[model samples]
Target chain A: MKGVGPTTPAASQPPLLEKEGRSSRGAVRAEVLLWLAQRASAAVLGIAVLIHLATMSYAVRGGISAAEILARTRGSLGWLLFYGVFVLAVAVHVPIGLRTIAQEWAGWRGAGLDVIVVAIAFALLALGWRAVWAVCA
Target chain B: MNRAWRARNHPAYWAFLVHRLSGLALAVFLPAHFLVLGQALRGEAGLEGALRWTDSPLVKVAEIAIVVLLAAHLTGGVRMLALEFLPWRDWQKSLAALAAGATVLFGLAFALALVGGG
Candidate 1:
C-alpha cells in the first residue's frame, strides 16, 4: 500500500520465547489479513477504474452537463450496484493503505490509531454511498 | 548518503513513490468529488450549478490533473499485481517505465478529448 515494504515485517521475527510468540501472533494475523484485503480490493478497483475512465472519457464529449450525467445514472440499477461494490472495496482498501503510510511516516500505531482508521473507513463508506444515492436516486 | 542513495534510486522505488502520492491525492479528492455529486440530491438546479462551475478553465486544468493522477495510481496498481502474481522476470523491472508512460498517455488522451470539445 504505502511503501510495498515487507508484507510480513513482524512475521519474519523468529519467536524466541512464548511471550514474543503470543504478542506477535495477533498483530501478524491482523496485518496479514489487512494486506490480503488491500490486494483483493486493488484487483476490484483496477477493473472499476478502467471502466470509469473509459465511460467518463466517452461521456464528456460535449462538455459535462448535469442532465447528461444524471440521465445515465438515475434509476439505473446497474450503476447503483456497480458503485455499491466499488465503495465497499474502497472502504476496505483505503484505510489499510493509509495505515501503512501513517506507520512509516508518522510512527502511529496501536489501538488508538486503529480505531481512528476504522472511523475513517466508515466515513468513506457513508460519503461514497451518499454519492451513489445522489446519482441513482 | 551514497549507499542510501544507491539503495533508493531504483525505478521501482520511484514507482512506489508515485503510487503512494497518487493514492493520497485521490483520497483527498474523493470527499470533494462526493460533495459535488451530492448536489444531485438537492435537485437538478443544484447539480446544474455545480456542473456549470466545473466548466471554468481552472477546473478543466484540475480535471486533467485528476485524470493523470488516476492513471498513475491505476497503472501502478496493475504493476503491483503483476509483480505479486506472475513469475519473476528481468523485464518486469521495465514495468515501472511502462506504467509511467501509460499514465502520461492516458492523461494526454483525456486532455485531447477535452480540447476537442469533450
Candidate 2:
C-alpha cells in the first residue's frame, strides 16, 4: 500500500517525463501540419495557375480590351469564385514558401520572421481579393 | 567563378535557381498586376487607357517573359512536390530534366499562341 500511495516516488517521475515528451511531440506535430498545409496549397495552385494562364491566353487572342475583359468577368459568379479560390491558395502558399527561403537564403528565423511572413500573407490576400472583386464584381 | 561555372552546367542546380528567381520575379510582378486590375474600378475609360498602354511592343515581349517565368516556377514547384511526397527512387534524379522540358514546352506554346498562325 505504501508503494501505491500518492506520495510514492515512482508515481511522481512519469508525469515529468510525460510533460517533456508531450512538448516535443506537439512541436513536431505543428511543424508537420505547416508542411502539409503548404504542400496542399501548392497542389491547388498548380491547377489554378494552369486555368488562369489558359484563360488569359484565349482572352488575349483577338486583342480584347480591358473593358471587354471586365464586361465578361463582371457579374459572373463563376469567375468570382474561381479567382477567390486562386487568391486564397496563393495567400496560403506564398508566405510559407517564403519563410523557407528567408531562413535558408537570408538566415532569418524565429518569431519575428514568422510575423513578417504572416503580414505578407495578409497583404497578398487583401490585394488579390480586391483585384478579383474589381474585375468580377 | 568556379562554383558558378559548375552550377551552370548542373541541371538540378539550374532548376533550383530558376525556381527561386522566378518566384522572386513573380512576387515583384504581382503588385503591378493587381494595380492594373484595379483600374477596372475606375470605369471603362480609365481601364481602356491602361490597357492601351500595355499594347506597346515592349509590354508584349514582357508578357511573354512573364509567362515563361510562371511556367518555370510552376514546373519547379511540381518537381519539389514530387520529391517531398514520393518515395525515393532512381527516377527522382530525372525530375530536373522533366521539369525543365515541361517549362520549355510551356514557353513555346505561349509564344505560338501570342504570334498566331503563319
The prediction achieving the highest lDDT against the true structure is 1
Among these predicted structures, which one has the highest DockQ?
Answer: 1
Task: Please give the RMSD of candidate 2 to the true structure.
Answer: 4.0
List, residue by residue over A1-137, the lDDT tens digit for candidate 1.
65445565554444555577787997899989999999999999999988888887888787988888899999999999999898898899889888899999999999999998999899999999998999887
Could you tally the backbone clashes for each prediction? 1, 0
Tens digits of per-residue lDDT for model 2, A1-137: 66896678877788898998999898789779889988899899999999987877777775758767987899999999999999899888888878888989999988898799889899999999988988899
Q: What is the lDDT for B30 in model 1?
A: 88
Write down the C-alpha DockQ for each prediction: 0.62, 0.51
- Say which docking band candidate 1 falls in: medium
Each prediction's TM-score against the native?
0.90, 0.84
How does candidate 1 score on lDDT?
0.89
Stretches of model 2 off by over 4 angstroms after superposition: A1-27, B1-9
TM-score of chain A of 1: 0.83
Ten-residue region with minimum lDDT total, candidate 1 chain A: A3-12
DockQ (model 1, Cα):
0.62
